[model samples]
Target chain A: MPYGYVNSMKTRPGHRDEVAAILTGGADGLRAAGCRLYVVGLDAADDVTIWVSEVWESKDHHDASLRLPETRAAITRAMPLLTGEFSSRETIIAGGLGVTAG
Target chain B: MPYGYVNSMKTRPGHRDEVAAILTGGADGLRAAGCRLYVVGLDAADDVTIWVSEVWESKDHHDASLRLPETRAAITRAMPLLTGEFSSRETIIAGGLGVTAG
Candidate 1:
């Protein structure tokens, strides 16, 4: 089964866009790291909150991605912009349209 | 851009599978309704919460889907199995792997 999560983060005031950019900046690397999906979304109702929905081949793939140089750099760039408030729901993807499970 | 959200719902005790079944039962109809993705995921840390990640061609398409007979019926059937606890973050999909935005 694919590992996935919908994670929410609050960026420091006036930094949501920057944080979003950092998150999506490493998309190509993530794809190469076995990411099935990596979506960055701006919260419709708030300026400081961003939502990231991701699906990886496995939890190991996701964890390993974070250790990649580019991924680590991106996180460093985004860390300062974040307010530290976050929420996440980790999941075992069951499958649906546009997603092929292994 | 595609309209999307990561929605979480808590099911009544021991009804998670039933609720998940109801959510995915109308998958075919959702595709015809312009849904790009509709992924059902089981929370890794809990048995009662389910996460649904969705992307629609537009918000209008999503709103219209709620009125479909199958959708309405599913909602009705699943309602009793739910705890009324929900959390969602509406989004405008920027772009990502596996999701084609309009």
Candidate 2:
């Protein structure tokens, strides 16, 4: 079906390189508003615990790429390196379970 | 604060009932294993896509819960009702964005 969005943010310990440089400057505006997959992972023994896996081609192009504006300034510069309370949810892939392709 | 896990599974067009049943069955096992929050939601427009939000005391707790037979069986039962694909990821809550209480 091709609709996906998994966003998990939890970064604090040492900032994780300023939240991966604000998620690589919004990752080309979320791949030019279509966003195939923009990933940022860090949690090898903590690092504040940040995880984002996004693949969008539906749900209205992931809600119009979160209203662009470079995805709201890369979430306002990652909201001050976060310490413990970021959450996100949106998903619709509906097939089975197969995600071992690194 | 606390660690959490978000699991998203997309179901078939007309299998929401069956899917929900399986989830309900496994709810206790999860809760008994120390799960704090376990909520399942279905999209308004699409009935196939499913999303699950889980809050655990810690990563270790979450991992251990999966080892429970009840948890595994629930997943296996829902496998057939799915249509597109299913994926999940875990994260730590680093204070920043706050979810509106429901």
Candidate 3:
């Protein structure tokens, strides 16, 4: 089954965009690292929250991704702008439209 | 800009699979209704929660889908299996991998 992760983070005031940019900047590397989907989103109803939704080939792939140079760098850049208040969930991609475990 | 919605719902004990089935059953129709992506995910660490991630061409398209016959029927079938516990976020698709507003 494809591993999924959905998370929301609160950025420091006025830093939401910066965090989002940093997150998306690493998308290219992620695709080659077994990521099937990697989305950076800005909360429509709030200015300080950013959401990231991801689907990976497996849990191991997701864990390995965090150690990649680009991924590590992106996390470093985004961390400073974040408030540390976050919520996340790890999921198993059962089945759905526009995506397949393959 | 594309509209994004990520939500989690708790299913009554032992009803997670049933609820997930109901949610994904309408996937075929969602694509025709302007849904770019619709994912039904089962919590990896929990058995009773299901997460749904979606990207729509526009908020209007998403709203209109709620009125579709299949959608309504699916919701009705799934409601009885849910526990009424939910968490959701509405977002703007800033940028990402494997997805585009168009």
For each candidate in turn, the TM-score is 0.93, 0.49, 0.96
Best by lDDT: 3
Question: Against the true structure, whose TM-score is highest?
Answer: 3
Evaluate model 1 with DockQ and give the value: 0.70
Per DockQ, the best of the predicted structures is 3
DockQ scores for all the models shown?
0.70, 0.08, 0.79
Clashes of 1: 0
What DockQ does candidate 3 score? 0.79
For model 1 chain B, the run of ten residues with the poorest summed lDDT? B93-102
Residue B64 of candidate 3: its Cα lDDT? 100
- For residues A1-102, what per-residue lDDT tens digits would candidate 1 score against the true structure? 899978889999898878877777777788899999987888899799888889999999999988998888888888888889998878988777777556
Stretches off by above 4 angstroms in model 2 are A1-102, B95-102
Share of native interface contacts present in candidate 2: 0.02
Task: Give the whole-model CA lDDT for all candidates, comma-separated.
Answer: 0.86, 0.60, 0.88
In the range A1-102, model 2's lDDT, one tens digit per residue, is: 446555566767788768866775565566667665544544444567666545566678878877878777777777777765776656544322221111
TM-score, chain B, model 2, is 0.78
Candidate 2 chain A, poorest ten consecutive residues by summed lDDT: A93-102
CAPRI tier for the interface of model 1 = medium
Q: Candidate 3 chain A: worst 10 consecutive residues by lDDT? A: A93-102
Worst 10 residues of 3 chain B by lDDT: B93-102
> What's the DockQ of model 2?
0.08
